[model samples]
Target: MNKRKISSLLAVTCITALIVSGCGGGSGKAEDKVVSEKDYEPYSKYESPVEFTIGRNTSHTNNLPKGDSIENNMATRYVESKVNVKAKVAWETDDMDQKLSLSMTTGELPDVMLVSRTIFNQLVDNDLIEDMTEVYEKTASEGVKNIYSSYGDLLLDQVKVDGKIMGLPMTNIGNQHQLLWIRKDWLDKVGGKLPQSVDDVWNLARTFVEKDASGTGKTIGFGMNQDAMNFSPIFAAYNAFPGQWIKKDGKVVYGSVQPEMKEALADLAEHYKEGLIDKQFAVRSDEEKEALVINGQAGMLFNPWWIGYTNYKDSIKQDPKAEWVAVSAPVDENGKFKTIRQDPVGGGIVVVRKGYPHPEAIMKSINLTTDFLYSLTDDAVQYKKEHASEGLTDHSRWNNEPTQIPMQVDYDDVLKRYYDDIMKADKAGSADGIQEDRVVSYEAYQEFKQKGTAVDANTYGEYLSRIEGQREANNPNLEVIPAGFYGTTETMKLKWANLQKMEQEMMLKIIMGQASIDAFDQFVSTWKKTGGDEITQEVEEMSSR
Candidate 1:
């Protein structure tokens, strides 16, 4: 119920996407003069402003300055001023998938939209999105192009159908694997070293609960929500990647049904039965699970590096003694911390409606925004300085842009840069070559060092996530296992929901001691009989292509 809790939940969800011949919509004239590829420029400003309607997918908190709306924020104004393109918000909603489904049913779509992978494929199949192959090549800035290329063909290839790029895929920030986050203070009090293996993690959690390290009788050893337990570090320790399509014996297979998963589930069941995990986790909301950590009722969780920027920051604010530290942990028998690599391309792709005039405008807007945000140009550098002087750090404004290929190229490398250039440099806090966008966090790190326990929550969060959390994310012993596939198959569309529901129910039941470990085998059998086999075959076929 806390405001920070809402913000943290929104932060997790905000992270996200066009048409064609055989496309679903009717052909229409260009809204502006169509320029040839030879005449195209990445930052070309149109003589007459090109206006496009956007079905904006927004976050719960825009954090805009007074009198500024999502339709006319700093990002929108910058795009219009630089590229002479006006973005009109036809409609905005936090639930883009639902809104887009309604739009598809009504046969009315905005000129542009950021859609999920499922919706993107649907739009392409319906032939309702624009082909942006030429537009991207001609109108994307060098930096934007470089960002896409950094992922090699892994990203762009996903949006390519019949060798034509149909939509722009959003590049994910790499190294988003879960890490073991534990209260260092609690571990110290409980008299245990850092956990090195699954057994060690269990012993430590048991110790924390048995000793009541939180000093509260209701202390929870491992705080987790219903679904999140599937992706916990413990599963990774057993080399089981639930919710992912993984390669096994060179065959694309569903991870949840793997033999390794049964072992992991059995371990989780044993732990749950022993009261190491939160007893009410199966029924708790995300906020309630987070409350365990934030309110000092839990000492550990498995989350990405960004947890420092979310729940733990609030925890520190409430209790300055709460010292959260991250480790790439619960190593397997081989002493390697293995984690599944998420799909590098995000869930969404940015697509323009079929027959929309000037598809190049989308690329142009993306180029301008990328250049400005990264301070790649002189004007952008000056703008960055001005914005910093104005004390504006509300990054939610960037989401207001009409079209974007949101990317953080070499994201993991940023931590290396911070370490080499800032942390271990001759000049302690000099941020000479760091990207302008990250300078704020650098400043926050400096403030955190100076202010320590008295530092504000925002400053503490930046330091924790960017510095401490990232350090663990860059662990040398971490084994990164790539997902076998990221796209949804046809069978998945019809049966994945029911299959996933059944899997979730079975996993939760087993963990809660309601169902025996043998239930996993039965669930697998039912899953295969009821479309799981078909989905796996489809996944193999797609992967082969």
Candidate 2:
């Protein structure tokens, strides 16, 4: 953190505010002596703008069209434009885990670093990051002030650690909810409405199997990438959100230990026994489940809205008639299934030196990033493909594209709205990699009430992998789980595992009828006797802070 730079930044903001507000005194000609308004100066005046060296995790340099890659990629550039300062991003690395760790070890942290809560904690514990509380309170401009107030508790909790605010945490934009995507055409074939209740879903899966709605006689009733990370939506179906680790009721609990978790597992085990789950699922990477779905070998999947655009639609090019639709994930009749939201913590914390330059710059970056992603227009065409992967033998990309924002959920909304506003934009005129003449099949679906069924009318770009028929298409679904809910402290981390494993293990056991639901009581007792007390205490303390 540069002290002189801080002085300059504060001075600049003060003077600007004064000059703009002070002009009220006279005719305001160049030579007119203007009385800057302010019942009086509340604090300091603006100093000359200074230069900063920012470090980012990116794939582009800061000299492309939008602002070169750096200028365009960060919202901080908006800050620069306002403060009349310039920044030279000293380093831009794509692998945040590797780069930040390396940078921390070398004691060369960026003036501003973008990272997640876990990493932020590690950095703070190591005494490598600065606290930004004063800066936030004093320097936040009007726009910066508003966002902080809007995000409120969420923003406050993310940056605070051990009762201290250390950095500017990233915020979630767009649809931060999960939705289930199912093949309605198959549902209709099975003489069923889309499954709504958990039991209803199971019954429908059985029907699909009995009837082979896909006509291939090989459709798996359900398919999901087996990664524990991607299991939130499915877990939600059973009323569970398995964060990497958690603390409940004051004890460290693990996901696998929960009795409900066991029930969930047993449910999975049952599906496995019935061959309703993808047989290859255990070994299937995220890529595999995706490929299975778009190829029609799997009729169901759990993923974000963008999946339809980037995965299924991309793969369906191989078979033009391939169609898909999305709906909110199914719940139990109690409507109490698990719907895991982001862990209320995310992206490593970004911190500036205590009393360093542009206190509001970090906040400005967040604002800019959000607006850039959600407030996109035709002029923003440059924003897309900033770091697009060129279809080739060797994959390469840069952080120069707008679509590169992994969470640009608004794209899903805009995509549908645009295509719907004028159907011609997507009519057969340009399906890109989409299957031509699929609408003819879709029309029949309409007669049966499948209008918004084909993901998003037609696809724009498509790609397929041979390993599995996983396709990438233009139909982007915006539904995604919340971000930043994974940053529990060390003690909570321990209790969370014990708790989760208890639930996970028991879920499988009960569904197998191997353990009766009555065992849930015993499991809860075990949890309480374990470290549940400590876990809950820590979580409650964290929330209070």
Clashes of 2: 97
What digit string (tens of lDDT, one per residue) describes model 1 on residues 1-545? 00112233222222211222211232244453467654378877888777777776663534556666655656566778887887777777879889987776555677788888878876676566788998888888887887788666777877888789998877676677788888899988877889898888889999998899989898878876687553557898888888888988999998999888899999988998899988998788878987888899998888887775686688877788777788778988888888776787665788998768778888887777777656667776776566553322455323423233232333324455554544643255476666555677778778877777577777777777877788888788888787889877778888989999998999889988999999999999999999999999988988887
Q: Give the C-alpha miss distance for residue 165 in model 2, angstroms.
A: 3.8
Q: List per-prediction Cα lDDT, in the order shown.
A: 0.74, 0.48
Poorest stretch of ten by lDDT in candidate 2: 463-472
Per-residue error (Å), model 1, residue 22: 13
The list of candidate 1 runs beyond 4 A from truth reads 1-33, 37-39, 58-62, 93-107, 228-231, 384-427
* TM-score for each predicted model, relative to the true structure: 0.87, 0.62
lDDT for position 188 in model 2: 66
> For model 2, what is the C-alpha lDDT against the true structure?
0.48
**In model 2, which runs have C-alpha deviations exceeding 4 angstroms?**
1-49, 58-81, 94-107, 122-130, 137-152, 161-164, 173-177, 227-234, 244-255, 336-338, 361-486, 491-545
Compose the digit string of candidate 2's lDDT tens values, residues 285-374.
767777776677666765554553366665455454555555554655455434434433334455663223344444434333444443
Candidate of highest lDDT: 1
